[model samples]
Target: MNLDWNFFEEHFPLAVSSLKNARSAGRLTHAFLLCSSNAEYRTAFPPLLASLAACEHPNEDFSPCGRCAVCREMAEGTFPDLITLAPSSLSRIIPIGESEDEVDSMRWFESLFYLSGMTESGWKIGIIHEADRMNEAAQNAFLKTLEEPPPKCMFILTTSHPAELLPTIRSRCQTIQLTDNRCKYSFPNSETLLPILHKLAFESKGSLLTAEDCATALIEFAETLGEEAEKTVAEKWAPRLAESENLESAGKALIEKRIKGEESCEYRRLRDLFLSMIHAYFAQLALLVSNTPAELLPNPELFEHSIRQNEAEEFGADRAFRCLAYAEDLLRAMRTNANDQLAIRAFCLKIAFK
Candidate 1:
């Protein structure tokens, strides 16, 4: 949708100027990376960028005026030229599967790449909301698109974690790193997660015996985190679901599919945020021990007073770095459908005793 260029000019002046300069110079690349850890900007900037591409009357700064019909369609999610591909509701993973026959048709982005757009503004924009969520099949398919993009077509990808994406995929796009404006554990359930992390962070790390207990607690924490988020999500969507449940079996099936999708995606997203927070806790220690600026800390105020200092003194910065590595591995495994408890246990053990 149309956005206030003023916002970008104020907050993201460099990013706006880069894109605008490229467009002005007739040098816009086939694919551009918009990396931001901020969740809201991840959701807001894609459509705004698409609107810029399709704006009939872009200002000198190259942002779309919100008044045009094209801009309105984008705001309404009815813009024919601006397409979006997000993760499937059921898996919270982009089902860019092998074929249309295998994929849930509603969430497909693979074949759509091969089709021509409505040619509105002579620029077709396809936005992938979470580039990291694309499965192997989806990534492979998209790599081909990048190799030989269609005429007047552009792909804008938004991602919080760039490491999860394939190196080849990353190589094809021009990366734009957005400032990390997103706060750590900024979601509704972060308060629930932070306390559990604090408990682990400050706990005496001596023997392997307590590692199992910590592991169990971590697993429970993840479960409770997901459940708390689901409760909120379910309540938010209950009215819409209530209406759909009374429909015929076929119609009811459709609504249920949508509901399940929301549940799975929301839970997974919340679960990942918790894992990221866990990593940030360890990373925070590593940063402080390395004498990095406190301003660079993702969650500067998260670690309890004297807790991280004690942990660093006891475990040493090298081990703390290993803990961050272990946490990253655990996050990777969990994303690949690894059992939650088993992965958390492995992570806890590796961090503490490995």
Candidate 2:
């Protein structure tokens, strides 16, 4: 929400223009999916868009005039009209039930629609960050809001993986692909790791990438990450863990559980990061096969310099798409409690030859 106007002026003129045009035309949609991979798309962009829609006073460019009552309230984040929801501390997953309050997010959100906005502009904006974290029940409950959105109210759902969302939910909204060119993700921090990933992905004719080796590497990486996380967590909680002399069994058990949970979360986060990078590499490979311009692809310059586009072509278009699909499937599968080492190996072995 604290974005420099100059940054938008340079990188996202089209996006800003579209928002302004929709407002002027009086044809803004009730629901929108602001999709992007970068975390900013969820955290910052929605509030910016919401402020734009809710503000009545604006300059010629249609940017919100900071002096306006609505703009000031939005900036203060004390605006009753704007509702925001995200995962709570109790659970990372977004569910339908209340979040420690009497009324849950879904209930509160619904109740707001019935009431009129506090502002003169009469805009009720709801921004859901990491919206895809909503479970099936929450997503289903959200259909009611999408089905018949109230007048002068807009809901913006932001997520990195729009495909994971329900089809019905997706159909109800206008999806805007917000580019994050500012983000430059370099894979395999050390040159050593990059070659390993590439070789496992695109090793030549006779030297096919094997499932066992890929799986082994992935498992090893995951284990190393997990061990590192444990060490960090152990160091952080050393006082608590070692202060068992005065602590009761229940208190000590709780501390131990917290440490384990933190370690597990860190491990999963690391695994997810690696999987996402692999998925991105495959996506870049597909773009290369189609001869997409560097600017058009994610990680713009990284792929051009690091990945050989012709190598992807040699892998075959159908195969590339298939591998991409497999990678996605693997990522989704890993979300569950299932052991992913076998899954990773299976996917790698198939892609190695296929």
Candidate 3:
């Protein structure tokens, strides 16, 4: 979890190298916009960047010394200057106001920055996680501060989708792009897992983080339902009944308990897993139509037994493309607070019947 050195060695090795050049040339930008497909890694990147900016021995190649007071404080999440802004709930949009609660949090963050900026280290760090979630009002409010940043203040905006950000805000900062790598997952016996992993990677559209999450969830789901029929049943029915009012009332009466509940993060995780699975399933169909050899296909067993059953001419590459579009739409619907169970059920049935 030593993200500072780990991130430096991994995706941002070039950024680490640029650090020395920028410092030597006195050309470091006051603000940075770090863009990446992996939202989790983008969130982790800011703290590492902050540690690098605040390092006492930044001139030394081995700096960030990990054991230093500042680094230790950062690792403990008590670093005065390192502030993160994120959505307060699953709705995934930051609230903007001068209300008591909002004011309190903002004051605490501003105080930390003010104190850190006054330190001899001469750097204060602020990270806006999920910058895409900032509403227009919130973004506009932050724009004024970004335009005239406090002296020695470094603002790092981490977003999965930079296109959603205002052009003016993006134009003011330097940009760094980070892509997740499967090799960085550190799964034991990963070499043995590479074939399936590679398939999921392609299914996730090159998002290794999404593929890894799907792989892990699929492994767990497979263990839960040992039989193929049971697995398919759960995949199909879990969503339909869970979101229906009839089932909600029946469960409440039978179990003498409430049934409507917030969608669990585990459910969202599994939805992503199923989406990836559907992608791989159709991809295999495409390969089968082209007369791909069994050993060359990612899931030859599935391809030979199930996918090939469908006529290649009837179910062509367009089927796969349509499924991808459906998955994207489901993802957007989830973000907008649609009923997760209904959205997932509809998505699954679309692919299952296709």
Candidate 4:
């Protein structure tokens, strides 16, 4: 609800401009599917857009006037016309309600939209955070409302996994790609990994020594990830622990267990970023082989050095494509709990022997 209008304008200027233009032209769609791989954007954008539509005093471009009473209410989630549905804590799924009275369910969410608008803006907005979390029944239940809502009604569905949603639901909404180049790849400690990729791509053509070194570096990177995760989580929990006076042993143990769980999750998230960067690296290589313009690459800055040095290696386009496939497989295997060190070694060997 606390949306940063300036930050959105700065980071996602195109998306913001498109939305504002649509609103100003009175051509805003009744339903929108805001898609993004970045979780932060997925969480932040829907409410901001809803606020823009419902703001009593919006700017010329339809950006919400944050000082207005309506904007403040929306920020505090007290706006009667705006409703948000998200996954439950335990199940991590949104469900079709047993009845219209069931709070925070698909049925309940739909029922609210039928009511008259509570504000003068005549905008009734519903936001579905992680819309992909809605189960089949929930999705089916909401389809009717998404297809035809009340007058001036708006529904926004935000998701990192759009493919999980039903095609019927997807077809009903206007798709908005909510990508921010600033942190899209967000590779952790990328400085240390890019050089290894440089060596693999141009310097060493499947050399055993380079592969061995890359494997060692990757394994060490994973270890460092764990250490960093632990330190970060511990520092976060330190102040709260210090503030607790005579905390019971059971409570302390529970806190410790929670800390450990968070540390594991953080480490895995960082590792996934590293994995994504590897995929991006190979993807860039394939693009390079295909004679793709440097500016058109996903991470243009990443390949600037190679472009500047005119280092187009004698690698075949097919080989570069194969490397992309290998990286995908490695990512899949890692997700399925494959041994990290072993995976790194095998991946390096595959690239080396290619």
Of the candidates numbered 2 and 4, which has the greater TM-score value? 4
lDDT of predicted model 1: 0.69
The top-ranked prediction according to lDDT is 4
List the lowest-lDDT window of 10 residues for candidate 3. Answer: 256-265
**Model 3 spans with C-alpha error above 4 angstroms:** 1-7, 103-123, 180-316
Rank candidates, TM-score, best first: 1, 3, 4, 2
Give model 3's TM-score versus the native structure.
0.62
Q: Model 1: residues >4 Å from true position, as ranges?
A: 1-8, 24-30, 36-41, 55-60, 66-98, 104-107, 113-124, 129-140, 147-152, 159-172, 179-183, 204-213, 224-269, 289-298, 304-319, 351-354
Choose 1 or 2, whichever is better by lDDT.
1
Using all chains and alpha carbons, the TM-scores for the candidates as numbered come to: 0.71, 0.56, 0.62, 0.58
| TM accuracy, model 4 | 0.58
Compose the digit string of candidate 1's lDDT tens values, residues 1-354: 223556656677888888889878778787877787655566567666777777788776676787788776665454656656667543557766545555443225556555766655777777776788888777887888899988778898888888889999999998877676344466565665666565555452555666776887778777786676678667866876688767898877755555564455456557657777887878887787776666666667666444545445765678778778887898778766547888887777776666
The collision pairs in model 3 are: none
Backbone clash numbers for all candidates listed: 2, 1, 0, 0
Local error of candidate 3 at residue 238 (angstroms)? 35
For model 3, residues 1-354, the per-residue Cα lDDT tens digits are 555566556657786677656755667687889987543456456666666667665546644666666776555444655566655455767656564246213333344554535355666777776677777877776777778878888888877679998888899888887765321322222223344533442345445455545545445443332243334434544554455546657653532211111112123223333444444555555565566665676555444433333455455566666766766766676566535555554554455444
